[model samples]
Target: MRIGIAGWFGSDNLGDEILLHTLVSCVRSVDESASFVVFSPNPDRVAALHRVDAERMPTLRARGAVGRQGTAQRAIRDCDILFLGPGTVFQERSPNLPWPGTLPLFARIVGMARLARTPVAPVGVGVREGGTPAGRRLLRVIGAASVAIGVRDQRSGSYFGARAQVIGDVAYALPIPDTQPAAAVEEAAGSARPTFALSMRPLAPDTEAGLLLSIGGCLDRLQADGWTGDFLPMAFGQDAQGEDDRDIYRRAFGNVLGLAGNPLNDREGTTLAGALDGWLTALAGYRLVIGTRLHAAVMAVALGVPTVAIAYERKVHDAFVDLGLGRFVVGPDVDAETLHRTATAAAGSPAEFREAAGRVARQGRIAREFVTATLKGLG
Candidate 1:
């Protein structure tokens, strides 16, 4: 079987990579002979990491110009099925970066797939704040074209009405490593102070400053309670124009331990599985995670660690709400005192939080079942 997967992938974003990994795994479990071709911004990187054939997704410059004869369009035309998403690909809510053409690009991709008579399935996806006009139209087309549409949250399902199935995020079903590095385990066990992991991203200047200040205050309070901090960068952008999470972390907490720096020197001959294992190992050590990035919190929760989600975007809150961990989510307008208190409270209720996360992980298996059943029908 030949399948084509498309999403906001290959951007050095750990979360998206993890989602891709999980989606591929789920599909392979049901169809061992399945072959995949991916559409990504960084095709070479996707090919290197996921061991799949890849083509660059149609960019804004190529918008409305992709014909049936175009390389990417031809590949999709030949594929038996197309899988679109596990990310907030439909959202136009980014304040710093505008994605005016993204939805239209997706519409064209799906339109091309439909023209070729290939089945399209949108899985583990979400819509942010009802999205733009193009995005809403894309959703309508997806509903009309797809064999099944599986949204990651309730709010996202509302966009498609009866067409959408409420499947949990694919990341929750990702396979966890049985063991971490011995040294990592020992360090975490030996540390006298409680460890915390932090994930931050780019935002509006004023909002960014406020978030940093709030985080700094939280760190101060955590330090007073004898907790140490580790800044995790889930995504590192290419070139100067893109936003880098590492830079954001450095600006917020200067010179702190950066887990994203690959402190364990884990990149030597690294594969996707190895990188994911290394990240999971590092995250397993944290007593708490304060995350602005959705996947950072997802990974933390999957590892059974308590997390405080900073909901700069609706998807963040939506994911937490799906996990039944909504109490841990705070908005950008949240004050430092509220953030600190929430973090402290979440940290204190570790058992309950972990249990809730585990339940969500269990629920995520429904996504795999949905895929399997859909594929079986296709066969």
Candidate 2:
């Protein structure tokens, strides 16, 4: 059997790559004979970065409908099954980025699969807030896909109608090497020096630029409270000069707190596994996490660190709420004083925080089983 996978990939971001690897690996575990045709923005880059032996399927530039039916049609025709899995596809958080013509892309791919007698599925997918008219239209079309649909959030599951199943984020199910000792994780948290981690993406093209100013101000307050700032950029899109944001935050710390530079730029790291391993290990000492990326915050939970989620959209809020800790989430426009107060309160309960982390670890194991079983059922 052959499988075709689609979504945001080939970027330097370790989180997206890990989710892709986990979904692909789970599918293959159930059917070892299956091979993959991955639809990626840049095939050669993805191949080199992940070392994945997948057939390179082209996608359009990050603009609206530029090459919609071009490469996806071909991939759909050739595969036994095609999947549009996880990523920020359903959310238009960055106004600068173009929205995919969802109806056309889905129709063409699903039509091709129908003509070729192939099955289609949407797995580990979630639809967050869609503010624009085009965005909401795309959400409706994605909801109507006549294939197996597994949504990560309760909101996205409701959007998918009757056939949809509510599962946790796919990254929760992704495998990590057992390198870090449990005792080491506990000891680091107990050190209690008030370490804070932040992972954020740039706002959409249409978003107000001053949003960055707000974030900078919040980080500055964090510094005054004697918090050490750690920054992780999840997906480095086309922007090269974006490290300035980190610099601004680091300077806000007034030299007392140190900054660990971009984890992706580390020369020694090659594979997604290596990058994530290095990044998580480096942050093992964090006491509080202020993360924008869903998986970055999930990584903190996986490593027994308590997190404060900067909820830019629904999925961010939903993920933490489902984990039994909504108090850690705050709005995108949150003020510096609010951020400082929230972090201070969150950091005080280290013991309870550790227990919550344990729950996430257990849930992660169950999430892995869900994906494995779903793949077997598909086969």
Candidate 3:
């Protein structure tokens, strides 16, 4: 069987890359002999990293649409189905980045699938309110073309009508690694100072600094109580889009936190496998997670570390609530007092967080079944 998978790939976002990894892994388990062709912005990187044939995805602008049609059609025509998303590819500028899903590639997915007469399967995709009429229309138009649709959270399901199933985040389907994480804030056993991991993005410009300061102040107070904090970088080259998570950390909390290095940006460049190992290890070492990145918070809970989330986006807020951690997510405004309060509660409730992780695993099992069954049905 041949499948064509597409999303915001090779964009240096590890969270998005994890989705690609888990997506391909899930599809392989469903059909071991299945071959894949991916369309990405960085075709070579995606091809090498995922070990699949990849074509540079076409630009969304009208000027170059025709020149790129052949590549899109070739990839689509060869596949039985075109898989789109497991990312926040359908959100509006309200949460920032005004494009209609991955630089308005939603239109491209529909156009190519239609031209090739291939079924489009949009699995574990996220959706949010669109500020503009055109943005709202693009979502409806693309969603109408999908053969089977799966959204990542409840709020997104509301946008796609009854056919959309809340299949959970595809990243949750990733297998738990057995490797011991790298030495982080203190990976040693029985450490006196407990440490927390933090991740942030260049969220809404108006409120980003305030949110950072609030969280930073909370961390300072916690450190005074013999607690420690570490900055974990989830994306490496997103600096072009001003979305690099590390840049904000350096600018906002550099005084309080230390740069823990990402594998991609390390002085000695590392392979994707090595980077993921170090990333997971650093996460596993933390006593708690206090961050805005949904995946980081999700992973912390998955690793049995209690996490307090700052819900900068609706998707993050909704996902945590669905996992029985609603009380653990703070506001976009994120006052220090509220963050400290939630962090305290989360740190004290390891068992509760473990149970939350179990709930995620349960959802992940269903999502995997959904992927396998969907692929089998297509075949």
lDDT of each: 0.79, 0.64, 0.78
Candidate 3 stretches with Cα past 4 Å from truth are 60-65, 94-96, 99-104, 131-138, 179-190, 266-271
Rank by TM-score (best first):
1, 3, 2
Candidate 3 structure quality by residue, lDDT tens digits, 1-379: 8888887787777788888888988998988998998877777777666678887677756467776877678878989888888787666564435544463666777787888899998889987655467766666777788888888987777676678888999988887766443234364565667877788877767788788778777887788878877887777664247668878877887888877656556424344654676677668777888878788888877777889888877778888888999889988797888788888998888889879978888988978988988887874
Task: Return the TM-score for candidate 3, rounded to 2 decimals.
Answer: 0.91
RMSD of each: 2.9, 4.4, 2.8
Over 53-128, each residue of candidate 2 has an lDDT whose tens digit, in order, gives 4543333435544464555566567776777776654555434444543434444555666676666666777764
Best-first order by lDDT: 1, 3, 2
Q: Against the hidden reference, what TM-scores do the models get? A: 0.91, 0.80, 0.91
Model 2, CA-based lDDT? 0.64
